[model samples]
Every structure is written in structure tokens, then in C-alpha cells.
Target: MNRRGFLMTASAAAAGFALAQAPGAAFAAPVRKALPRLKTQQVGSGDINFGYHSAGPEEGRPVVLLHDFGYDIHSFTEVIPLLAEQGFRVLVPYMRGHGSTRFKDKSIARSAQPEALGADTLTVIDSLHHPEAVVAGFGQGAVAARAFAQLKPTRCKGIVAVDGLWRPVPERAALQKDRRGFARKLWTANSPDWRFDEAVFARAAVSFDNPDFAAILTDTPSNAAVPTVSAPVLTLRGSASGIPVDDPTARMIEGAGHNLPLEAPQAFADAIAEMVRNAKWRT
Candidate 1:
């Protein structure tokens, strides 16, 4: 099985073990928390019904936070509240092929190249009724953010990215033994727990099912199109994540790894808050 498949198996095992410890666990439904200002919403974009989590006041400055591969909106569970409390309208969308977002045209492959994602993002921006907004993202989501800034320069005020630079897929000799091994290595490398987070991979199962995105995602160019981006950009990386500091805009988290947002949520928030302040954006 591929890494995504294996991780789901592992996560199921873990959840099963927890259930075995408590009889009737299977029968008990999960308790939903009373998360004020936190809601999952949908917007009708052409050819897609996008599902996303919305937070903060309706009239606040809008900021769209996109999650990395294998993560849904929940990846921003901690960060969303932080941004929302800071008086920003935050939207964490389940990217195409992730969570509840789905493509309406059955014939279209679920392509996730930045170009496609950029268009979708702009559609969401229009749906939100915002003239323009800040686009911040992680991993593959960063690709989407940068793409949006590049593709729709007028629709973005600034950008915040964490360790999402895409390099050309290394030569086979420099990579894992095979496709599954390579994928697993990466999936765990950037993960918050240093392993596939059960919830994360489970949420990404649908994304993995789409074979159309593999080439664009796996064979990224070394200079993954950051230079053409017009808006102000702030790139952050964990000290441990080997993402190269090619761009002068890049910064490092003192002691962290790929999932820098989770490792240093406040610092991440502060960087974004500072970027908003620097750009003089008004909510």
C-alpha cells in the first residue's frame, strides 16, 4: 500500500486500540465542542461547492488559511482562534480533494497544481465578497497561496507561508526505495508528531484517491514559482526542516520542524499579525 493508505491503516489501529480499552466506544458518538465563532460553511464556486471553516466577525479583514497535504481545516484549530481573536476574518478551506470540498464535473481530474488552485482560491474570494485578502498557507496550501498571489495580484494584500517551498523531486537515487516509501517518508517528515497524525491522513484519504495531482505535487520545480509572486511575502521555516533559505524573505523558527504552525502557534500567529501590521491592512 502507498504511504497514505498505510497511515490510514495505522490510524485505524490506534483508534481501534483506544476503543478496545473502553467497551461501547464504537456506539458513542464524538462530542462536538461549543466553539464560539467557529463554523464549517460552504460557498458555491463555479464547478465546486467549497466547504470551509469560518471564524471571526463578518466585517473583519478576511484572511484565507489553507492547510497542507493530509490536513483539513482542523490543522488550524489552534491558529484560527488566534487569528480570529486578533480581529481578522479567517477562512480555513478544505482544499479540493480534501474534506468536504468536491469537484462537480466528474470528468475533470482533481488536479492540484498551483495554477488550478489559484483560480479556485480567487473564486472563493469572490464568493466571500472581499475585494482582496491575505492568503496564508502551509505545504501544498502554500503553493496555492503563492499561486493566488501570482495569478491574481489584485486580490491579495500579503502572504504568510511556512516551509512550503517545492523543490524538484529528487533523483531516484536521492529518494526512497520506491513510490510508497518516498511518500511515507515525506508524510511523516513534515508531520507535527514526527508521524502521520491519524486525523490528518484520514482527512486526506479523498485527496490521495485522486491520481491526477501526483505529478504536479511530487515533481515540483526547484524554483517553484515564488519569484513571480507580486504581493509581499513572509516565509517561515523550522530550524529542523531542511527547506532551503533561497528567498531573502524567508525566516526561521528557533527550534521547530516542518509543522511549524503547530510547533509554534503563537510565533506563527505573531509573524502573520506582524505582516498584516507591516502591510497596514485594515480589517
Candidate 2:
């Protein structure tokens, strides 16, 4: 199907499905009063200066939360505190070409390949002096999380991926021509249940203004490799998302959309917590 046709079908699918929840089924929302202000920090990681938000105790079990495409660290604003309360040190980083993250070397290509992103993840973990971390990711961030696990399984305790692991689009030029329009369509199609205001979108949209945004989005590695992930994996999908489930063990978050972290922060954090409790790491 053509792009237009594909989008139409996806939007319809997103609108048609409603989460089948039992009566009185509910999840806890993040408490505003208990939420602590996340401290912003920067780390020099290879070619990139990574800017990230850190929360919870310094010695708490590490949990890295990676945001999806078209979003930044702010995507997990509510979710971070909940994990922190559970004694997990949460680190939400702005991906390359997003927010305050910048490339240090001018000659280096601005690439968002799985390998590049995975390397960045390792840098974050090493910067914190942690042996291993339970990594959680949303959308494109999920791809990164998976990449990190494959690249360095020993350093990844477990993985929580939501609506991730999609193959790259073949028509890169066509999509690159209208990045913003394409992003808007994806938002509407994948999150039909979400009624996000312009203010919320604008907050994340500003990250797109980075000079390397277009280059990173359009860059496609010739050999995009996916090694086997040995770490325990917990896959998730939003009830109303248009993305298909590739993992048989994937759990559906009730009443959520494509932006699972934003729409269901409680469920997202809970999944990470569960992975941390269940996954066994090599000693």
C-alpha cells in the first residue's frame, strides 16, 4: 500500500480497538506531590555530548528510559518519579540531534542508526558507573534499547520495549521531504485516542529544530544489524496503537496509545519494575 493508504488503515485500526478491561480495573497515576525535580546533567560520550535528566538515589538500581522519535527526555517526566520512589535511579536522555544533545565533531556524520544509538546507551550507563541497567524504551527508543542489549548483553539487565522494533521505511526521501507532516500523521494514526493539545506537542516539537535533525532522520545504515538479545525482554503495546505485536509475550496497556509512556506512565514504569525484579543478570 502507498503511504496515504497505509496511514488511513492505521488510523482506522487505532480508532476501532478499545482496551477490554475488567470492571474497576485501574492503575496508579504519578502523584504530583511526591514527584521530585529531575536534575539535568551532561556527559561526553564519544562524538556526542549527551544531555539527560537524572532522578532518585545515587546508589539506587539503575533504570534508563529512552524516548521515542519526535520526543525528548520530557516524555518520561511523570514516569521518572514513580520509578525513583521504587528505589530505581532513572536516567532519561535526549537522543542525538534532539534537545540539548549535540555532536562534538563536525566531520562525523549525523546518524541515528541502531548501532549509534546503542553506543550512546552504553555511554550513559558507563557515565553513571553502573555495572548494568534495566533499560526501557518507547517507539524508536525501543529500537535503541534492543540495539543496546544486542550490542552489549552483559551490561543490560533486562529490556522493556513498547511499540518498537519496526523496520526502517524504504522511501526515505519521500518522508524526509515532509518530516513534520509525516510525524503529525504518525501521531494521529498511532494515538487516535489521545487528545493532545498544541502546547504539549510544541513542547516536544521544539527538539526538531536541531540542525542535524533532518540528517539523522534520513540516515540509513547499509547494514542495519540486529543481534540476538539474550537479556530478558518485556514487550508492550498500547491498546489503541496501530503498531502490530511481533512478540508473543507482549502485554497490552489498557486505554493507551502509541505514546505509551506519555499516555500510561504508571503502566510503563510498572513494566520496567517488573523486568528488574524478574530478569537475572550474569554475575
Find the candidate with the highest TM-score and give its number.
2
In model 2, which runs have C-alpha deviations exceeding 4 angstroms?
1-39, 170-180, 220-226, 281-283
TM-score of each: 0.72, 0.80
lDDT tens digits, residue span 181-277, model 1: 3334454444323433344434444444433224334333344454367788888777755344344556877777555666678878887787766
Give candidate 2's total backbone clashes. Answer: 0
The candidate that wins on lDDT is: 2
Candidate 1 vs. true structure, TM-score = 0.72
Predictions in order: lDDT? 0.61, 0.69
lDDT tens readout by residue for model 2, 1-283:
1110001111222221222121211212222332233457798747888888888877777899988665667778889889989887788888887777889889998877777888999988777677788899876687788889988988898988876644444334534575554455556656666766555565666676777766775663433444469888888888877565455677988889778888899999898989877767443
